[model samples]
Target chain A: MSNLKKDSLFAGSVKDAAAGGLVALALFGMMIGMQADVATGLGGQLGINYRWGAVAIAVVIVFAGRLLLNLFVWKSDKPVTRTVGSLLPKASSFSGLGRFATPVFLVLAVVLPFLLTYFLGTRGSRQYLDLAILVTTYVMLGWGLNIVVGLAGLLDLGYVAFYAVGAYSYALLAQYFGFSFWVCLPLAGILAAFWGIILGFPVLRLRGDYLAIVTLAFGEIIRVVLLNWYDFTGGPDGLSNIPRPSFFGLDFERGEGNFADFFGLEYNSIHRIIFLYYVILAMALVTNLVTMRLRKLPIGRAWEALREDEIACRSLGINTTNTKLTAFALGAMFGGFAGSFFATRQGFISPESFTFMESAVILAIVVLGGLGSQIGVVIAAVVMIGGFEFFRGLEEYRMLVFGLLMVVIMVWRPRGLISVRTPSISLSGKAKGISADLVQEGHG
Target chain B: MSNWDNNPVLAIEHLTMRFGGLVAVGDLSFNVGRGDITALIGPNGAGKTTVFNCATGFYKPTEGRIVMNRANGEHYLLERMPDFQISAKAKVARTFQNIRLFGGMTLLENLMVAQHNPLMLASNFTIGGVFGLSGFKSAERKAVDKARYWLDKTGLLDRADGPAADLPYGDQRRLEIARAMCSGPELLCLDEPAAGLNPKESAELNTLLNAIRDEHATSILLIEHDMSVVMEISDHVVVLDYGEKISDGTPEQVKNDPKVIAAYLGVPDDEVDDVEEEVGL
Candidate 1:
């Protein structure tokens, strides 16, 4: 028999410790590289305290963690460990995880506000709810973009253009025409979808990188127009005092017929935060539900087919023009919905918020989620947005850690966190999801 | 020939296709008999695919009329319509030389997508589909039934749920044909269906083609390089050389035609007899 455990546990600790120490030192140094010692003319200076101590702790943690991981995981000779090491991750292995992940997430999301309020008190709960709302917004945007990029295989690098259209639509409509958030929401989606078709028609013949470039240009054009056309869009100053969404016309303000007052509860600011969290949670769920339903519909299957092979889709009598247009329009519609929600949430709208970087982030979320995988988008959005928020205190290292985490995840799971895709149609009794590897990359 | 319909299913009148300086197909004319297997054979660069492309509306011929007479007695000027309209309204479905099955989708989805136009109408543009209305549901059920029918006919019912690309090469070819059949095409154009098939698979293809012609009453226009398959299965043959039709007749007549032997053997017309003797055809 082959000697499975020849090396002693402590054989490489010193070398590993030294390597870990060097890495930790470099990381800590990067984390605290440049700082201004702001002294208030008191006895002490306010700056990063004991940068060396932080680095030492980081080194010790890395050394200990690396040693433990190497001893148990890398050196284990158990058959189970060997089997797991030998096994490649597959769509089948992760397929079961998807079945439970959504429900668990939904339940957790539903009870999160109540749980936080009960434990942290109302004043303390606002921050967590705010974070949850931010995460949910990105999740919603990811799902919306998933329709065009993931299911239809269209590479849209200017998705934020639609979000801008939506936000501007709500902002301009409310400012000029005195429309409520409820009325403006659908209008914004309609306007965004209209713009999507307008953008879609001229570029129907373009694919791949060319399509991406054109979409990026279109996004820039919208932003520029919003910036220049001060007369209609308030120019660079942006539109402020945008209306907030209410619960069936009951505002969450501290006046008569306010939500708290109508409900016979004391006027607490946390109610609005909690309410906003649920609103976004509900919108995200609806987006997920509609997308899931569309995945099983004929149009959805047509989108997948179009993605697989446009020539083949044409051969089969599918109207490729209409297919591409619908994907653009629908994806833009959802983006608009999220945009309107954003306008309501911020009570302000600006061209600066809908930048190309926003599009890149949303597109990254879709790709990292695995194209055409719904639940994958949720996980990716949480990881991306939540991680960015979590590392906010590490101002210098925030982007470094975030970028590193993304690179690690991508290297570990090249097909994104969840790569399994449910087939639009199945002939057997049950639907068997296919691996995303079997699918071709989206051309448009 | 017992059930062969005498009417001409597709008529190409003086079809000419040009790519800027090069004429891919020049003055190619032929008639595909209804429910008949017609083969278009040529050497490399003879532009057999260009003819297929023109006939299927993928390319509008530089000059000519492609008149397709459907089973419903509707006549269509195929060149005037877009590529998808040729398949959707003209009821002319085709497969590519490279076997263009939707590799990522289940075999069933590939067929269901072929029925997109009808399903789109049945779903009332997604309003009914979203609500799961019975009208749309029944239409979907029928579409599934049609897909299943074709899958069963192609002997791929067992692999219906798997990705179409996962099937072997020969099966992908059959799946392409089955997917076209799901659209209920009046004429099916196949490009090199027997190119990479084993002898057993080739024989199986023959059975499937004949069944489609005899049972389904679907006319076939195929561009094939395999002489044995063409000679064995095709009821009629058209030969092309240098983008021009050299011969058009029954298989036996085309096989013996001096011009076809000259085209295939790349010999002078007068020396065709000697070339034929050497080629042992």
Candidate 2:
């Protein structure tokens, strides 16, 4: 537009290009340069090949890319950020999007398995069906952790321990007592919730990083106990032949009077897979529904108040201990239900299945999904788990790509995908019709 | 005690609070009359807030008896009770000096959270609420009505939907008082409520606190540095110097007390007459 503006833009672009080029040179040079390569190709046998030429080319490409970005993307950053920053305050204050997001996501999830079956024709869509199941499990886990980390503002790094508790409870009961999957589902949840309360008591006084370390230790302690308690927990070998949930007491086994006969349809393994998908889908929806409802309750508001300021909540006469414990217990309850489903689906689990990495993945889902947002958790689970499943062939680079995507996302939206919050209760629901003039007319 | 009511709603006897090596409050003794506005005035860091914290059970007194007598014929030993019990059981409510309202929550939700104990019981531990039962539904409706009443009283009914943190400093102060009032406490303890308020907001706060005392019949123990607020609304004033009561009487008597003048001016006892004359006491 102006001479000064144009000159500054050019100067800034040059600076950006030079900085990007230097960074590229340093990174590529260390990673690719000065490395030993015994080459058998390019007319060489057991010869060390220097990649300085390739490294230079890469640095040049990076410089060009930065220059291009500076001209287009970076140039637009000011207007874009200005517009976004201006719009976010109004958008985040109160929006209709938060109300409709969950129902829309629920519809999509309900039709996902059917859609995959329709497009890929059931047999070819087995992997997609399994991926959907996996995604829903994480969605449930993310929603569960959303209660503690998002709503209550408690950093629980060992949430997977509750999952382990549920899975193992189901596994042990089914294996020892010959219990059905349905019989052990509630039992698993109860047992996991019991463990949640037990773990909650000692850490009630701890907050922030201290609480995180204690919960992390609790997770690891559970894993170690499961690994060493061989006689009771089946040790590292893990319990097998865990019973699968039947379709209303109808088995999917290949025998007379199986699920197919009961339904008067042809028997196929896809039937069981589809059934499992629906089961977890139902579980995830229930978790979402319960969390949404709880967000409106007194205890739910107490949890949020506690999150905002514990001393203030206590000063207001809220029982901080009960609030924190309820958050932990309820979060663990959902994790437990999901764990039971995980056990029934896999039919086997060991200490390796409930490692610290699992907790990290679930925590990442909640964080990246926008903490306290149910629909955000669903979308994030689909993106992360579905992306991992789809990129199975690129296994070596999957984590790197995933990490880069996460960094990019954090840079783009530090608060996560749906950071805007909608208050659970409002008096504005009535104030909408009343005029401000009338309100001011009566006031002193 | 000649013309004043003898029954005290809160009595702090020899209340001493120590932090390892330093004594924050030492042998402080005071009584807050029923339905009276009692002001606790002192210089900065004179353990004014420490006494409020001890009375509200935020800090346990090292060796003291802090007793609260509720109108319902219940007496609570505040030092022996947990912080929440001091408010919920002993009917004591408090506001923070820093204005610790739930920032992310709406103004209405912030007020509703103050009435958590009763609603929690009515909701049947959330089971009835989740099921949308008639009892819990009515209770929720009542909670909303109560929150709206407070919102209207604080002149925040129009902005009830906005986040509490988005409000300006003065509105936030009013909302904090409104939130504390929603709990319907017998004794309200406020810590520096007029710290950053302008003159107009301060006058408005004075009217509100006077209304609270006359109409709500709630006793108030206020920790304030604003002498205008203290002299305007306080029925009795207790001046503290280094965690000990230096003067306690009606505002006129305490204002003209020589020890209070010495404490306020940081002067020796012999120089109090000259300092009082210099300040036109």
Candidate 3:
């Protein structure tokens, strides 16, 4: 048994290294391309005193650097163990910390920005705050979809429909009734959840590809409705000049009634951005908490059972229709929250903001992170979103690079970044950490 | 035989299952006596599995009444119930011809899922489960204990955490039986449980069946091609040929019947005398 585990560990490390190497090589090639472009100006018409010898030297230097790093790691005894230990510091603690980790990380995420701004000062913190907020939103979206696609095994191609519903609900409600952000948030979630139930009822008998196609159609239908409904949604133009959230009636603008003036501090737009960041962070954390708790519940188990085998789940007396509906409702509710946050953040709402591309990116994060893994989703969001932002300078080739990266990661780990852990039901009625052996056994 | 007052747990009357013009089970009538291990034996396309499917509500009979009497005095018209509800509410559990345990789940989970109804009942539709209720926890613990108990019974306790598909063929067959037994059904229907099992595994299965009959008072209806398994464990044997009943009697009686011999041994009716003479029957 130990030998088998060791072999698997070895195989996993080798695959991970190969993926990392491919990513590094791609980045290196991009850097070389940029240098070449600088040497050869517009349309390759202007040429500088660039030598092919220098390019060869640069390539050799990079190759030697990579080889040396590989040799250092390979020469070290117990390289696999060392690599895995560094990658997953709490590998053994995963089972024990599974339940507590999500909440703990959530609290830390909420407090991290404030701590960073306080300690490091607010010099160029807006970018970091924006990245954090973006990552959090995707994390929430991934968790929401995980309920339907990961737990219930429902392929929802148009999950963005629910997200659009939430954003529009918030936009329309706040616009018409002059409601607060807090009030509009839950309203959006409720409306989106209602749509989820509606979607669920029609696809009760469908499974697999049929269910996926219907969901894709439903998404398109929602988008089309938003596009055609000129009176309510303003047609393709969408709702604009949406109200920004205030801090207890004190606006964040520069004036006597502004938030900074009320609090007796110098006004900076970063404050508003940071405040909004934390607000979205809190929302995302709540989404994660609810999903994690639900997973331990009977409904969660039913979803998993459905995913594993629907026929067997039915045989066990589980009401599959109810289970599927609950999954859809819960997932949609979170998507609604993200949508509301997006509307509030941008101070505008548009159909273009909730396109199918948004859904694809969110789904990609969920899949890359590992289905049903909260932490994996967060990490995936950070890497994919942060990488996309960083590669903005790459121009037309950015998407091509991102696509290659996705393919590389998928080939390296077909099961996703973090595979689903085996569920543990203790004899003492206490929840225990999921064991790796148990996960292997369950996934076999 | 026991008194007729102890009516059969499962009774199929005029059960006829047809696909297009091809009749799989035609006017089949049989009574699976309570606490009896009944074996249904037939050649390929003889409709033994078809009868099991009709009884389990997988394929509704074209013309039949499947009456199943639970030990709790609740009688279920199995043919009328949906496929899922039949196994859930009627307490009529069945194992497939090919072992069909949830391969992605652990061996223990496969068994626990079989006890799904009872667990859900204890948790009251899982409201208690969401609140982390102590009662639900206790119920979950009970499920785990039950799963472990059955795993031990099947000698698969050591492999409880392993995936069902990872088990060897014999172990997989045993695991399937354990999963069905975990459902706590009054009537258990096993389709070819002894298929691909060696002599030792077959003997072990016989022991398990006998134990289930004596301890749980489960009425077992089995479809088996292995004569040894049928002859050793079955209290009654029913033979089918061309979707029609050929013989129904005790194992010894069925073994001695000329029709059963011709159907199973493949000796032509006209040449049976010559074959019997040659074999010194």
Candidate 4:
């Protein structure tokens, strides 16, 4: 310790910098050393400009940065570094402040648009409202997928297939039968659930990785079928001009009997936006309410039991086959509801909207939130959707930043940001939170 | 004695399980007497687990049927039933050789899950429960009370709120037994319940098993390698060797049987008589 004050921090960093400089040189040589330019315009002669000076400077900077990092961080036992981990709540239970946290967040969510409206005016708040709506959509999707992936421990890579089914069901029903959004909503959920059962039947005996592969294949099949079945699905062009959901048949636009006219207020575009946001919020809350209630019910307990050990569940007299199917169906039904909402919100229908990437993002939210944790999903959804909005300006580097954030989260909390499985019931007349280590992440 | 010749709780009639030309349990027949602890003991790979699997509906025997008779006069063909139905309808609950407690769930939740069938009915498949129906709530309270009873019995009432994974090894073994009891079974099957227990823990297990049999009126069928546990608690013992029953009698009678002693001592086929004679048989 006495000798370190003399040369360890300074001399040790300098010694390591030579190797760091060599690494930086290898990395930045092609990145900063060479540049290609078109001499004139579109078809002009291509020229290669080589400037070794920039590369040398980049190497120097990297070396300098490495040296500074070592001196400040690596060399010191207690380094001065900042982390956002402290800002994140433990979320172990709704023990103390957590009970109020949900209601407080709900109240805030309910008042957010109005708050922005009062401050920035209606038109200015539209962007923020749209972002909130997107966040709510993911929250709804996350809760839906949580029932399958989180509760039942079924790795469903084809969740978007159900979402697409719901969207297409609503679109097709509205187009062909002239059904209203109200009529098609339940129909969409039912159709999606039906497809879920169809998928469930074949994969009854499969679990873990095998279940995931089959589901991935099923998702691709749905997309490819939609791509090829031009007459039925409109192929690559997709169906557009999908009908928007009114305020219970009271149109938001100007007419003989419109929402604004009925309310005696001047027609504002933000009204529909606000209405859609509330609709999504209400739907998300319903998903949460149902999931919360189900947790105490036998069906939900069976799902958790099945997740922990299927053989044990069977031995304990849980009908695992039926339990797994119900998980698939119920999860798909909610996805269907959100998909129909997506259709109405965009006033468009497209197979592209329900890609594997969408499924991955939704699954990633459930996982990153901590499986089986309801509040965790909400936090993950907001951080994912809202954070992406914040990172949109990064453009080319946005994906790099996103990947870095995921890696950081995984490193800090491998289970999740909020990885606590609170017991649905407690013997002490109070809910005790099960710590993350005790909670199974599930094999799937 | 409540033997199968009079009133058997479970009867295995020539049960045979073949896995691709290799017979795991070859034409095994046994009777688990009503309200009696029947021990099925064997050396390693003697198909004790295979028989348990067949009886518990994990495996379908190539031949023979298993009949289970409940005290309420309900008789079931255990072989024809599904895995869950064996426990749910036939009233047969079993613990695995490996402790299979729901690690992520609280001990109470694990026990609660065992009472799923009855609670599922009372909840009306969750439609009534979601609306907070009084009927469902009362049923749930009753279920919780039952779970509490088992947890208290296992001496884990103080730690019921904790996840089952947090339980120590000896506690987990007792928890598995507690979980099985939560199902309200007329017959309980335990595979290697004393496999990894200390002497004190093993003695405690003996007490619990005996209490379950005496007080609860539940018959027990166990596969054990622990002779002390078997001899102390078993009312009847069935000895198996190479997928075949070598001896079957009361523990005292079975212990003195030369064939069972030969099987346990691993005497050669030709030296069975010589070994018996040397032991002063």
Candidate 5:
């Protein structure tokens, strides 16, 4: 102690480093300190193997890392925001380059399939096109759920039930009624919106956790009904042989009277993929367009106002009942459209596809994109769905990476990416985005 | 009480609100004369808010009728209606004791939300908005103009684009009133408009309330604890104590009432009933 540096700052850094080492020890003690493996190379009983060296290394690294952070970041006199999240990047980029971000992304989405085909050629383009189609479907779903969770501030854990409804509506209608894909698409959306209203009525009075629990149960109930009702729905066998969407009335199945024959082009399966890609792109863009328009309408303002303060909304004579139901119906309508497209794209419908995890992922996209932000939904969907696909080879670490990313995002931008809100009706045409803190994230 | 034979915007007849066994308000009645400022004055927990809530359709009175009469001679049974109908069909607007501005919306947006009924009808319930109909566009412009008009009146036009949560305490209070006015209400109910304001702001609120009564055809009904505010601009005063009316008259008449003084100044317990009876409650 007598030989140690006299400076208090040095002492403080040492103390912080020591504390970090202790925390790392406490955290890693069980997970990494002792491994469960056979000590011998030969077959032996599985037992605890002490790895004190690993623990020692972890502690040393933690200590060194903490020391560096304290010296260069935390204790610096330059007013540093000392946190890993804050260290990454401030979410202040809603200006400058942000002005063109939407247009750039829109252009990229429109030309993605052709761009991929141009670069990767015929054989290689299929996989990337499929990935793009899958991501666009999720973008559509994220925007749909954004209506309920983001704009209206209603926490709906049963959102996938509407998706399931749309998928099944299209499948059953085609299988039984002999309807085409185009006919079933709008019908599927209508049916899903009807179900949304049915779900909305019972949960009208419930708020926060109660609403979440009911919606979760509702989603499960829909899946359970689909799974167990074998006679009409084919039970666990699931509905299959759903028809594909036609260009006007033309199919793309590499035969006479198909898309390629009609267009006088090669009968490549990539044509179908390309067509489906455009179909989903168009669908996703329609959802975005409708939602953006809604945000400026009285109904959209009513939804947002209800989210901010339901009592205030009611006091102002805004019909909260209609507002909530419209949110559910409109949100479910988009989910339904996406679901119908999903069924057509996959040519199969099953209960396994519409699970609670799907709802959570869509919700995660909405939350990560920032509630009430239309463009945020697009960015979050791409980053999450695309990133998930990118890490598909590392299946076990994929979730670990995803969870770590979520934690980082929560700490960094607590309100989600692009959290700031553009005012719906700005007197000054160029009014700046409202701070994320000023935007209501909704109670539920 | 001033007679409302010529006209009355709101009439609360035998209004009784009972929560379980406790009587929050019991057999209370008052009439707000058309285009006049009527103040409901009471101390803490004297059922002033309860009466306001009942009148605004937040609470259905256990018994009695809350009648709102428009200039067209159409009257609404307020307690029979929902909270929104009270504000919408009955043309009544209210502010909270604790301000309930849509904190996320801008001052202009907050007022525009109050004009939702009119704009919703004009936009054809949002379907027409998608098509960019000229009618809806013009309605939106008119709605903005109305919001701006209220904003200018409240002196918040400069900060119309700013978020409501960012306003100062006094400005937020005034903004609440402005938002209520944008609804085009025949009757406006204000709850503690001068709450938490300094003397200067309180005086400004007095001027604003007087200006509203003078300039607009809207009648004002308010719940106020601030005696200075109650006495300055009130055209009529109704005092409540322990869920019962102790006095009802003009501000000068009510201010000098012995029972009003006794209820406010806290007289001897034995003389309390005497004061209550002398006032014929």
Candidate 6:
């Protein structure tokens, strides 16, 4: 059966390669043709254009070379044997590599700053630090929401409400009580978790669209409260000059006996940026580890069972209400952590920052990455966030391009980028095998 | 007969299920004796399916007292119990007439899901399941072993990892039975088990039912249209006609009854000769 499956997969890959090669060749041809036409039009207008037609010819030659490669490899029956043999080692290697992913990631996290400093010096290190902070923050949010959307299959449109609650909680607590960032972070998480439970209670009976609508309303209500409760939140003006994280008595701001003077290092903003980056990274790793652990737990299995079939889950005597609430609370708690981190990093808190669009983007990251896939979510965040940053120069066209890319991806891979082929772990520690029945019938 | 007064596996007292204006099961009173293969044989829409639903807690009867006696000596008012609780507490497992297996799940998973209640109990209401305790692991192993046992029993062990939907029509029906059996129910309610099966499959089903009755000691309440399956496996048969019980006796007795024949025809006047001709009496 394994050999048969391997054979079939090899055949599929060959077909995919041939199809991809043909599409690439066609695209190359079109690019060349369009470029030549543009050059001729430029020559007509300016009448001083040099012969740049060689570029188009060169592109065509490259396309032909790719076509020949496809014909030589993809068209042969021997390709199946070669593909199967080559893929077997890679598949085995992947299984072996899976065990070391966590350790490898941990090492990279510790080593990344030094690597950046060594290669790009202080100026470039600051930019890398900023990127790391953004990625880690989003990664934390994604892992948190994974509990709600991926595990419990609850569509939460108001997840950012919890984030907002955390941000505001830290901002309010720190300002009023002179609470440090570390002290306020857990308080923020607790507050968000409380709100999550409250939100979960009302939407317990609602599923799918109704749950989404109610959650969306909940988020909007939180935002509205912040807007109207001017006595506390400062209304539309928002909280400003929120106290940043300090190492003991040393602050990030440039002054006598500040962080730089305390540490005997030059006063660069990279100090704070690097600190925030590591903070968020640690938080993200914690979220990921906790979620991964939860997935192996009974509640995790119950969540998956519920997602697959609610009736079956209930019949199993699983208390779905509690299960759902736990998911919401846990996810919301992580979101709160990220929010607190954001507040501390930016030294500001505002309702405008935690808008519906922020929630949509995070949710998109989850979906685009693939539901219930941690690695997929991280990859999705990198692509989406980096893509958005890259297209920042396009201004008005950025959204248009982003929207088009999403539509194209959805069309090609409706299941998301890294669709979960099988469950992560079974309650029964049996050898995992792809059920032919499931393969034929598709997912529930 | 077999000391039903001690405690019937399933007892329906004054069961009347009304679908708006129409009564589907009207004051139907019956007792399914312990370890008996009782067939609820009737023409189409004779409330056999409705009775099955009511017994399985799928529908709340307009008026009824459905007392389900568990193997552990606990009695449950099934009508009052929620669908999940009925399966979990009452231990009254059932298969749908249309074979409602979780098509997307593997055959093994389907069977394992049936043992969900027991596994939950072993895990102390899923707390151990969450923590992956030794108890939970043992329970899970037991559940998997039970699933495998049932799959093997149903001649589906080889196809255990195959999705239930991908199974052939006959195999799918057998898989459904295997799933229900995995629940370890004292009272197994099979609704039209032979509906879409061929003669050979139907015959195999009879053997399977008999084995379940004898070996597992499970009292079965079967709603079947196939005369062969009804006549072969049913120790006792109850005939219904338009929400009313026409006859209730042994399979031979119900088969030869004039009232049962008339009920089948839907006309009282055509009973005499038709009954004689059908039963060759």
Q: Which DockQ-derived CAPRI band holds candidate 2?
A: medium
The Cα error of candidate 5 at residue A5, in Å, is 6.1
Q: Pick the candidate with the highest DockQ.
A: 4
* lDDT for position A284 in model 1: 87
Q: Rate the local accuracy (lDDT) of all candidates.
A: 0.87, 0.86, 0.79, 0.89, 0.89, 0.77
lDDT, model 4, position A294: 95
Kindly report which residue pairs in candidate 5 clash with one another. A230-A235
Models ranked on TM-score:
5, 4, 2, 1, 3, 6
* Reference contacts preserved by each model: 0.87, 0.70, 0.26, 0.85, 0.70, 0.23
Pairs that clash in candidate 4: none
Best by TM-score: 5
Q: Could you give candidate 6's per-residue lDDT for residues B1-281 as a string of tens digits?
A: 34444457989999999999999999999889898899998888889989988887778999989999878878999999877777777877888777666665567666666665566667776566656678877777777788788877889887776556678999988987887778777888888899899999898999999999999988999988888888888877888888889888888888778788777765566457865676554
Measured against the native two-chain assembly using Cα atoms, what DockQ does each of the candidate structures obtain, in the order listed?
Answer: 0.69, 0.54, 0.27, 0.77, 0.73, 0.23
lDDT (Cα, tens digit) per residue for candidate 3, span A1-444: 978765765665556556655665566555543343343446666444434455555655655555555444654356564776567434444444445666776677868778768876787677778877887888889889977887777888789999999999999998889888889999999999999999999988887778878888898889989998999999888898888988888888998988999999999888888888878877887887777766655667667777776766665556677878988888899999899988999887778787778888888888887677778788788889988887889988999999999997786565566654555343333423333232321110
**Model 6 lDDT tens row, A45-139:** 53333333654555556555555555446544465557745654332232233346647766887788878878999787776677777877887
Task: Provide TM-scores for the models.
Answer: 0.88, 0.91, 0.80, 0.92, 0.93, 0.77
What is candidate 2's local distance difference test score? 0.86
Give the DockQ ranking, best first.
4, 5, 1, 2, 3, 6
Model 6 docking category: incorrect
**lDDT score for residue B36 of model 1:** 88
> Cα lDDT for residue A361, model 2?
92
Query: Per-residue lDDT of B56-130 in model 3, one digit per residue for the tens?
Result: 777888998999888888999988988778887788888888666676566776777777777777777767766
DockQ head-to-head 3 vs 4, winner: 4
